[model samples]
Target: MSAPLLQVNGLVKRFGGLVAVNGVDFSVAQGEIVGLLGPNGSGKTTVINLISGALPPTAGSVALQGQALTGLPAFRVARAGVARTFQLVRVLGSMDCVENVQAGLAFGTQNLPQRASRAQALKLLERVGMADFAHTTASELTYINQKRLELARALALRPRLLLLDEWLSGLNPSELVDGIALLRSLREEGITMLMVEHVMEAIRALCDRCVIMNAGSRIADGPPAAALAEPAVVRAYLGDDDA
Candidate 1:
C-alpha cells in the first residue's frame, strides 16, 4: 500500500563502451529480504554498487522512501540509512574487534558518544557471535569470524536497509545454520535486506522473493521457487552443463 522502501528505475552503468548494467529495475519493500541471483558477470554486484553509491549510474534513478540517492557518494548513502558488507569482508586489521565496530558506531547514521558507542559496539559484537573475541586483533580472526565482525560493524551503522554481498560465501554446514538464524533475527527486528548470494539453499530458506538476472538484464522476478523454475532462468543460471 505504501511506497516501497527502495526503488531503482532504469538503472544502468557503463565503463567506457561496455555497459555493465543495462536498464535494470527493481524495488524492495519494507522488512523484505529480496535475493539477487545471477550467474557470474550478470551485473549483480554492479547493481548493488549503484544502489549503495559505490558506483555512479550512467542513467536512471535510485530512491529510498522517495528520497533520491543516485549519484550521491557512498558515505552519504550510509548516512541515509543504508549499510552494506563487501564481497570480501573488510575490517580494521590492526584494531580489536570491538574497536572496529566502535568506529562504525562513531561515524554512522546516528553518531553516539564515545562511552555509549563502545558499549553499543560490544553489544553488536555479541549479536554477531564475536563478543568472545572482542579483544582479538581483527587480522588474526579466522575468515568466518571476520565475516561476522564485518556484519557487526554494518549493524553498528543502524541502517534500515542492509546490502549483503555474498555474506554466505564461506560457511560450513553448522555455521550456515547459525548464519540463517541470525539473518532471521535481523528480519524480525525489521531490517530490509538485498542479498547477493550464490547458495541456492540459503536463498530458498531466506528469501521471500528473488530477482534473477543475466547479461545485465532481469529475466525472472517472483517467489524463489517459481522464478528459479522459469525456463529462461534455468538457461541463465541453473541448467545442467548445458541447458
Candidate 2:
C-alpha cells in the first residue's frame, strides 16, 4: 500500500497519575475501512480523542496525510480533512433536523456559508436516509433517525477520513443492518473510514481490516477473519477456551 492516510506512532496519553493510553502505534491507509475493536475500558475511544485533538498526546506523534498534527486544537484538527461522529448523538433539541445538520456542516469549516446551505444539508440527510425527518427537532426524532442525523453532520465536511465511534451502540436488528450498509457506502463514495465498534457481526461485515487493542496497546492487526480469530484477541476480548 502507499503511505498511510493517518499514522499514529507510539501514541500515549496520561492523566495525572493514570496512564489512559500507552505507547501504541497504528495506521490507516488510503481507502480502507479499518475497525478498532476491544473490550470496554480498552482505550479505543481515548485513541479517537487523541487523533481528533480532543486530548493532546503525552507522547508520540499523529500524522494525517503526511502532515503532523501535534498540539493542534480539536477544531483545527477537524478542519484538516478529519471528521468524527461520537457514540453519543448531540443535536440541537430546539432546532429542526435540517438545522442540526446545518450545524454539523459548519463544524470545522472556515466558510460557513458554503457548508450551511439547504441543498447541501438536504443532500447529506438524504444520503443517510434521514431526509424525511429533515423538518423535525432533535427531540422529535426517533433514536435511529437521530443517529443517522449525526452521521449526516459528520459527512458535511467532505472529510477524507471519518472516524465512527460506537455508531451502532443501540439499534434493533433492522437498524443495525441498515446502519452498516450506510457506513459501508461511504467507502464506495471514496471516503476512508475508521470505526470503533462493539458489534462483532457489524465489524466483521463492514471492515476490510481489524485492529485489536488491549490495556492501551495493540494486541493484533490483520484482516477481520485473521485478526479476530487470533488467540490473543479471542483470549483478551472473546475469552479463552478451557484447557
Candidate 3:
C-alpha cells in the first residue's frame, strides 16, 4: 500500500523530570478520520502539540507523505500541509469572522491574493455554518460559534492533514450531532484527520479507527468499538475493578 498520509513514530515529550508523552505511535491514512482517545491528562493533547510543532519532541519523529516534520516550527509544519485546532478555542477576537478566516488563507500554504482569500473565507464560513456572521467580531460570538470560526480558519489553510484537539468538546447534544456531520463531510472531502475527543457518539459516528492512550502511553489501537472495549482502555477510563 502507499505510505500513510501522516506517520508518527515513537513520539515522546518531556518537561524536565516529567514525561508528558511516552513513546506513542500512530498513523492516519489519507481520507481517513482517526480518533485519539484518552481521558484528561492522558497525553493526547501533548501528542497533538508534538505533531503540530507547537512543542518539540524529546525523541521520535513526525512525517507527512514521507517528508520529515520533526523539529520544524509550527508555521513551517502548517505550511507543510498540516493544520490544527487547540483543545481550548482560539480565534482572532478582534477580527470579523470573514477577516479571521482570510488571515488563515493569507498565511497558509498557498498565500492566496486578498480577493481570492476573502471569497474562500466566506465559503469556509458557510461550510462551518457561520456565513450569516461574516461581519460579526469573533469576540462577540458564543463559545460554540467561536469554535466554528476556528474550524473555518483551519479549513482556510486547505490542509491535507488536520489535527483536532478536543474540537468537539463543550457542544450541546444538537450541536454535537451537527459537529459530527460536519467532520464526516470534511473527511468525505478528502481531509485526513486525527482528532482527540471524549464524545463517544462523535467517535462512533466519525472515526474509522481509534488510538487509545493512558498516562502517556498507548493502550489500544483498532476499530473504535474494539479498541474502546480493550481491558486496558476500560481500566484507564474507569478503574481496575471495572476492567
C-alpha RMSD for every candidate: 1.2, 1.8, 0.8
Give the lowest summed-lDDT range of ten residues in model 2. 107-116
Question: Which residue pairs in candidate 3 collide?
Answer: none
- lDDT tens digits, residue span 1-243, model 2: 579999999999998988878998889998999999888888999999999888999999999989998678988888898888887877688999788778777774645575447778899899999878889888988877888888888888888899989888788899899988888788989999999998888988889899899888889999999998888888886566631
The CA lDDT at 181 in model 3 is 89
lDDT of 3 by residue, 18-74 (tens): 988999998889999999989899999999999899999999999999999999999
Q: TM-scores across all candidates?
A: 0.97, 0.94, 0.98
Off by over 4 Å in 3: none
> Model 2: how far is 224 from its true place, Å?
0.8
Top TM-score prediction, candidate number: 3
lDDT of 3 at 127: 100
RMSD (Cα, Å) of model 2: 1.8
lDDT of each: 0.93, 0.86, 0.92
lDDT for model 3 = 0.92
Off by over 4 Å in 1: 238-242
Clash pairs (backbone) in predicted model 2: none
For residues 1-243, could you state the per-residue lDDT of candidate 1 as single tens digits?
A: 999999999999899998888999899999999999999999999999999999999999999999999999998999899999999889999999989998888768566788888889999999998889999999999999999999999999889999999999889999999999999999999999999999888999999999889988888889999999888998886566666
Q: Which is better, 1 or 3, measured by TM-score?
A: 3
| Model 2 stretches astray by more than 4 angstroms | 108-116, 238-243
